[model samples]
Target: MKRLMLIGITVAALAGVAAAAPVSVEIATEPGLNVTAPQKWLQLFAEIGQTGVRIRGMRAGERPRLEELGGSRRVVGVLTRRGDLLLPGGKFRQRDRAALADYFDRVAKDGAEGVEAPRGRFDLTEKQFRTAYDALSEPLGFATKDQPPRAVVERVRDRLPIALEIDRAAERTLNNAGPLAEDLEPLTVGAALAVMLARDGLALTPEHPRGGEVRLRVAVAGDVADSWPVGYDPPASPRETAPVLFEFLSVEVEGFTLTEALDAITPRLGGLPVYWDHASIAEAGVDPASTQVRFERKRTYYKRLIDKLVFQARLKSRLRVDEAGTAFLWIGR
Candidate 1:
């Protein structure tokens, strides 16, 4: 009898504790809040189980000012870490109530998981900027055989999410440039565009308008003064960025032209495309095809090997990124 009595007492105690603490949402209203706001919130959370929510108004001299929680006109409520949701009451439509409830639920879930939510407009803006950059970094490729600069742009514009614009001057030049003979290796959309544009002495420039849309514009290389490069300098060491280029390889060239050496080396670059700055090369009067290259049969990494070859040919090599954020080697005077 004594054992049964003790078991009954323990069960009663657990029941009382469970009843005392239930899942809930607190809806605290500020002055000027619509009278029906509390009822609406209660109904919204009704199916979400017993929300032990209470509708109460703030006292006249309460501390939090409207400015502290965004503006009254712009904000509906401020979610607090102190387990209270303060709503600045105003007439709310069904859609508005739904939106507020959805946001409230998200905040509660985030809080439970110990995740900090984005605060204010600055964090949101930064997030958007990062997203845009990420999009450009996506790898892209298309057929380049017999495709002229204009045709390449048109084909790429269809695949790209952002807008691609060609000004009148650039269009005239691109249309005249004959179809590119060489099919460029796979590269980022930005890098591919850079190579195609370089063929016509045109360049790509990004335009930002008031509405936060990013558009790429094609302009005459001479007219822009500065254009986006084929790829950016590697952020990491050469070994990390182009590990294959750092691997030792044996090469013996008795008397091969620079052009021939490049043709042989291009296949070993692990798919990295190479762009020739024709304009600068012409200005410097350097002909890679005629310049004879001599290499002693030795084991060396391609990085050093190419450097010596370019130096002998009176040219320089730079790692750069195109509009699509693809890395490529740009060889120029």
Candidate 2:
């Protein structure tokens, strides 16, 4: 098995590092894709993010799939170098337009595009896009691939340019702190250690409008460690700000999972309101599992009501219509 080969290398390294009767502890996870990683936080996370963490082993094939580790049931295709997990969640749809558009304009501009289509192949014209519907268009998928619109992603072993692909989930961690990664690395390391101790998952929530969040599962061993968020200003977009991720080795958190710290510090950690109607509208417009709507349109209609009043020899006709009758018709919109 590919996993066996990948493990062979790590095991060899561990053989030397940990010697006979290494301090190894195993835990049973309800989530699949169990990690038999190193006891060290750095080594453990490094391995999980490396090429060895594959569907079956290190290499990803056409039909290659994710080992569905935790959180929601996800069937990640193949991971790009930056740890971006492209879900088989299908494509984007009309309702998902805003999110997808933001993704293309923001994150996509920074990472690689896992799948390909000629420039503007989806529809170069907005008018055409409005009339075209595809499940691949949906911004994100929360549950099963059977969901109306799924993520249409390609299998890849390496990272794509930010312009082509960015881990959308990670986007949520972007924050006002400027450069997220710069400050995030230390925090990540600390969180890795704490989560390892707690036997929990690490979730990063956005601290501000400008930043995004990324969630990581614990896969190593270690106790409390020192960590801190050394701020760095990330590149600014016309509409948003960027938070640093990190490289600061000194800032440390004691005995806390990354999620716990993020929950304590991330500006938006609890919950945010999402419009279900938006997803429903997107689903109605696109479906990859069945017939996909390739054409979309938006329709608007107005009706005028006339009331005539006659006084003496004078007759007057007036039309009155309120905005209440006004409706936004997304039908083929």
Candidate 3:
């Protein structure tokens, strides 16, 4: 009877201890983004109770202020050019050489006091070029009536952006005469394409099937187990069910803008024939087969940009605007 009473008292004490103990648990999360991701991507993680910026993509670089946004919110991206897809010697021009030549000429002739100084490259006509040069040389320009003989003349190609250095690099890669692959430096993406082409044993040709011009429009969507991450690691799964998808949107055997063709097929993403607007893919990405991409304007002097974009899985998203500051950036599984 005495032992039983002691046991009862001990049980009561144990129950009290259990009741006083606190219960706690930790919740795990999906993988996030990398350091170079825009602040917006990181902010998403912050919203979801994570710290720092993490990223998952085709590649990541340690470049700060991508296109000069600011620290901690730089843009990290991949650049790809249209190559074998083009007919031999066929290329779309982005920089205007003539404009570049004339603009820099004025910079060399006139000092920094000149207001009409050129910035980078521009598209120009001969008449425009001549008129611009005349403005800088005239008295109304920078030089005085007495003319400053000692005025310093500096060359832009050598002084700023160092065009000569750039040209030398380009020349080295041009290869002059070699296999198309040898001549094509292909940049960073070539590594992957080379592997893919080799596996198929297929040699890409610049010539079109019809021996003319053709354009390809491509749309991309990335998914992740958890995209909004903090700090320097990549999303857990950069691989996706469909990381890349392409549509012929249009075909111009002579001259074409791939974007123009993409516009036509923009409405075909939904079930091929049925048109839909609203879609989602959990919290991850859009269904390329049924979605369109849009952009947001972050910098507007030349083009708009997106600070951050989020997409949901299975979402039939559309292009709100080509280069707007935001798009459907899918995150989370």
Q: TM-scores of the models, in the given order?
A: 0.57, 0.14, 0.13
- Which of the two candidates, 1 or 2, achieves a greater lDDT against the reference? 1
RMSD of 1: 19.1
Candidate 3, poorest ten consecutive residues by summed lDDT: 211-220
Clash count per candidate: 9, 76, 37
TM-score of predicted model 3?
0.13
lDDT (tens digit, per residue) of candidate 2 on 1-333: 857965764454344331111111121112233253212222432333322322333332443232323321222343333333333332333234354334333222212121222224322223222222121122222221221110111111011111112233322222111211111111222221221122111121111111121112212112113211111122343112211111112223344432233333333312211111122223345321232111112221111000000111121211211111111111110
Worst 10 residues of 2 by lDDT: 304-313
**Between candidates 2 and 3, the lDDT winner:** 3
Root-mean-square deviation per candidate: 19.1, 29.0, 34.7
TM-score winner, 1 or 2? 1
After superposition, which runs of candidate 1 have C-alpha atoms over 4 Å from their true positions?
A: 1-135, 320-327
Candidate 3 residue runs with Cα over 4 Å from true position? 1-185, 188-190, 194-285, 294-333
* Full candidate order by TM-score, most accurate first: 1, 2, 3
